[model samples]
Target chain A: MPTNKPSLKGKLPTELKVMERLALVEQFLAKLKVDFEAAGFRRNRLVNDGIADGLNLVSNAVELLAEESYEDADRICRVAWIRAHFARAIFDAEMTEHFLGEGVFLELDDGGTTDWRTFASEELAELQEEIVNLRKQIKDRSAKRGKK
Target chain B: MIDDVAKLLSKWLSGQRSNKLMSTVVEAMTEARQKVRASDSPFKSLARKCIDRAEDAYQEAIYQLKDGEPKLCFQHCKQGLKYISMAMLHLSDLNGNATTFAIEQGGADESIIDLSKAIAAFKTSVEYTNCEVTVEMKERLKESVRLFFLAVSFVEREDDNEAKRCAHGGLLYVYLLSKESEEKLQSNAVDAEALERCHGSAISRIVSLIDELSDTNSTLQEASVESHGRIKLYLDAARRTVDRCISAYLDNESDALSQLAKAGMMELRMARRLIEYAKYPTSTAEPEEEPIEEVDQPTDNFRGRVARLQRLLRDEDEEVAVVRRLGVVNTYYSRARALFASGELSEAERYARSAHLDIDFARQLLLDKHATYSDLI
Candidate 1:
């Protein structure tokens, strides 16, 4: 017990624990840099603007963290998180349109028909399929119960 | 070429139907001239002419209805109603004896005819006559006419919801007319017995039709949640439109009323979108994280990192600033990793994404070293 072996029950000094956390934070950020490069989000101007603004807040939080002003740091980090969240949402919405085409997105957004005749025909087909599925479900349930 | 154009114009004019109201007006004028020559006073003759015009309009309305033009029919009926009221006022004015008779008679009898009483009965009726008619009365008549026609149009379109809305509005006008009549009686403006004899049955019929239409609409609207929402939207839109129309009527801006009505219709369409959203629930791929909930009592390390990042960004040197900014990104990334290790996937994704954004921004700033503070700002 008196040997130099680390004990599970022992608590690390506050300074050492903080240093460990800082190192972990650094490693995590390095991995994020790699993820961003892979995602090709660097080419997005709006995202770049968001990140720049976020970094400004993040850097401020870090300084507060170093000074042990944890509350202020947390506030700044929370704000940065919100900024980043909104930026990603905007990017994702745009990406969806790019991949799915505008016409499909418009239909989903407004529940309107581009061509009423075509839409009516499609709706009729869908209704027929739904009725068939409902009938099948009823039959299966009755059979499972051994009903006459 | 000029001769050909003239011939074309003549052909078009020949093909067009004559204005129904104008035709009725001409017939009325002829009848009025004949009646004035025979009658002791021109007032009674003029009233007779109004009645004739009203009858003509009514006949035309019947023809329009047969032709499947409910809106036109409604307009004709409205004209008929207006003329009928005017005729009553004229008859009342034939002798000052009408008001005196009304005062003497107590029951609801038609014997009482007082122009002043009729004017006082409805605020709208007050505006239709100049010394003989009130402009307010004319405006109310016009509004009633519009509402009646709109209701018929909705019915013709097979839009029961909108039809009901319009019918209800028309009914309100009818009720106002009745109320005005009653007030006139109360103030001794007209004999109560006279009003009952004159306008009672017509008012009752209009009220009954309105009630029936309104009930039918309610039942239809109640069939489903979606229908109910639709009905509510239409009713609310109609109410707003009517309010606007009233204001426009008061301002005497008839043209503006049409424009406002169009705007109201546009707003109704927009509200339909809100109704759709309210009726259906949207789906999200992933479960939402309580990021805010977690931050209510943030951990010590989280606070420390935030503080450090804030300090780093404030550095004067651009290079140091970039490094510190990167460090801030790292802090969030580290938090995401910890959350990920704890199996909080949604929270982890959120933090990780934020970290990625910061890194990209920092890289961009580093690449554009020549960018000034003003550019960043």
Candidate 2:
């Protein structure tokens, strides 16, 4: 009875817990690296430069984790995660249109060029799909982490 | 539409038909095409080979007709007819049965197509704001779009004058909207702009809601000078509801807090719509038996802690990371929007406040990241 263990009284199921949203952010970084390489997109300026810059937040997150600043590390990574998700979705749509021979080069606020179609509401369903999958992934990963 | 294209084709064809060599070939192709009138033909398989070639050539010729020389257009058209004739000869070898249908081509003037597409693009450009317009300006915009549609219809009939008038009407509304935007933008100065000017804070800073809500209140107070009529009533209701909600939050009355939150949200919505409606400029002053919402100096009634979140959201331009300890706050706003769309407003509001901690905990977290988060889920 004096064991230094959490009792199973009035506890919510571990599977329903939502704390490990960071798990999804980690996976987002991993996936982006593989996707860019597979798509033959070099992580540099002139192509996906914003995403490349944003991905640096993950390294910062890891460094904070080493320093035992879990909350700040999570915040940093989560910011990077959503920002990266947006950049990835935009780039994915742009690349799709390019491959389909329907993309146009639009000028950015900064005098850069992109293959993003100016009118793009059709691909929103794809965005919702990603969000759903991400939620599922978060739940599963959170459950796994709770075991430790 | 057909008459416009046919005039061009008939004028060209009659000239071509004059040549003796062309006359003989045209006669043969005409007979071949006429021979394929059967509804059910056993020799359809035999005729298919030549018909495929004929259709391909005809399609290619149509594009040539769009831009290339009339000579190339004619050559491709003739190539298609030759294939049809060969199909006829092949059908004759199979006891003269065929299932080939007639191959006809038509073209609209390129300028007409271009103009129609341009009108569609104009329709899209109008939905987006030139700054933010008043409702009267939007009513004018609605009329403008109506005229644009009329322009599209007129262009279809090739009535250039009617189309020009409609297009001009649409552009005039747009011009008025621009003028309104210029006047509106020039006249009012917002406190939030000053807040935004405090750099190293663009979408990155931990926001304090007190500053933003005060800014919003001040801006509304400025606008409340004009005939806000019933909007003032709604704002008053919203502000009171917010105060009650904050009290409920402190008293641990979750049920009352939920009801008060929803009531406050509704009041805010009505206030917004009424403001837009009241602001619509007309020739005469609106007779308000009820006086407009009077903006008072920071009274005891306006100050509430948790209530500020409701007001802060109305600042659509508010940075997401305003409060400390953003436990999925940004995504919650977005998720709440989606849930709102799916007719789940109750759940949406819950999600929107998904990061709310105990008041004391929040205060501590504001100082540092050491807050109890039992309510996050």
Candidate 3:
């Protein structure tokens, strides 16, 4: 037990372990090289063009997100999170009111053209009901059979 | 009274010889429920018991249908039909049970045929009944007959192309009609009864279609053809659904409803797997991973185009005309992208380059004209 050997108890099954590793690899490997190139262009624009032009650069960044390519979707998700964080720093209260009132939220939504919240919600509810029904059936059968 | 109930039951059952068992059973159950609730006699107990059994059987059948087990669903529906017929029997056996209304309604099961025959009969029926039939009744009968054929077809051999196509087309037509009805239901334009009839038919047809392909007995060739036909059908249904959702959302400026369109796309991708499998008959690997669900619904926003061009243009009046060129460019781009995605790379490149050329022309025009909003560009 004290030997420098692998223990099966704490480890994932070999198949599952391989699959988990593969999933991570897929995520990293599938990323587009175009995003990095686009980010570089955006950074250059911000430095050379001032805030208004910087805003335009950000708009371009958002456009890339709207492209709906898998890599672009991931990048957009990350950028949206980053922009929300950055909003507190650069946008003053009055500016924030104006920016968010009719601007940021709209742009944020515009970046992600597809909204799947409703169908997802409906499907999840149906699935949950089915699972609950199955659980009840199992419980009833177990009780009838005098099984723990 | 028993004689009267027997006469009514016989009449109703005979009437359903040309109509759907489900509709007949549902109607019978509703009337039985009301009669039991209204009556206080000891015979009411038997009526109540029969009604409850009928309901259970109907619900069980619907559940089986949703589970993608059409054979099981058919069994349940058969059971439901039996229970309903029996309920009518028991009600007839009662001392004073006679339906007040005339029972010879024409909505009986008039067309019963094998898959191919059912297809021709359905189209003919629709055409013939176009003048005499109410829109609601036409849709209801069409949906029910389609589902019934689909359920029966699933259990049959699929070696014949005619039978297969009949099943495929019938299911597709029903799905399209049901989806249209579902939209009306969502908009509060149709009642639950009509919606349920349409919805149930769609669900039943879809489940049967899936079950046929997934059956252990199905050959890969059988699955391939069926799945390919179904993909086209499903894509068309998805497009129509998305179009309705988009039109409603845009015209009303309501809350976002693009999610339905996205979900439809996801479903289309699921069907697309079979098409891909058909292309590579020898591959041992599973189908290619589906595209991420996205609301790729194309919107030709002429106004948005005008606004965008206005920002780029120096001439205000010329902005509208310039917008048309942008549409041409966008269409070429979209077609190219789609062709490329479908693995027709040469055609894709041609269309892509065509798009590039049109975009350049528009850009040059904007620059040359020095459009009013040229400063912004």
Question: Each model's interface RMSD (Å)?
Answer: 41.8, 31.6, 34.7
User: Candidate 2 lDDT, tens digit per residue, A21-135?
Assistant: 3333333444555666677632323226545645566445444543445555544543454344434443453454346553342211211112111111112222323334434
By DockQ, the better pick of 1 and 2 is: 2
Misplaced by over 4 Å in model 2 are A1-20, A40-47, A109-148, B1-377
Writing each residue's lDDT as its tens digit, candidate 1 over B303-343 gives 33333233223311236655665566656656765675575
| Model 1 chain A lowest lDDT segment of ten | A105-114
Q: Which ten contiguous residues of candidate 1 chain B have the minimum total lDDT?
A: B101-110
- Candidate 1 docks with a DockQ of 0.01
> Per DockQ, what order, best first?
2, 3, 1
C-alpha-based local distance difference test score of model 2: 0.40
| TM-score, ranked from best to worst | 2, 3, 1
Indicate the residue-level lDDT of B233 in model 2: 69
Candidate 1 off by > 4 Å? A1-46, A101-148, B1-377
Which TM-score value belongs to model 3? 0.19
Interface RMSD of 1: 41.8
> Model 1: how far is A26 from its true place, Å?
7.8
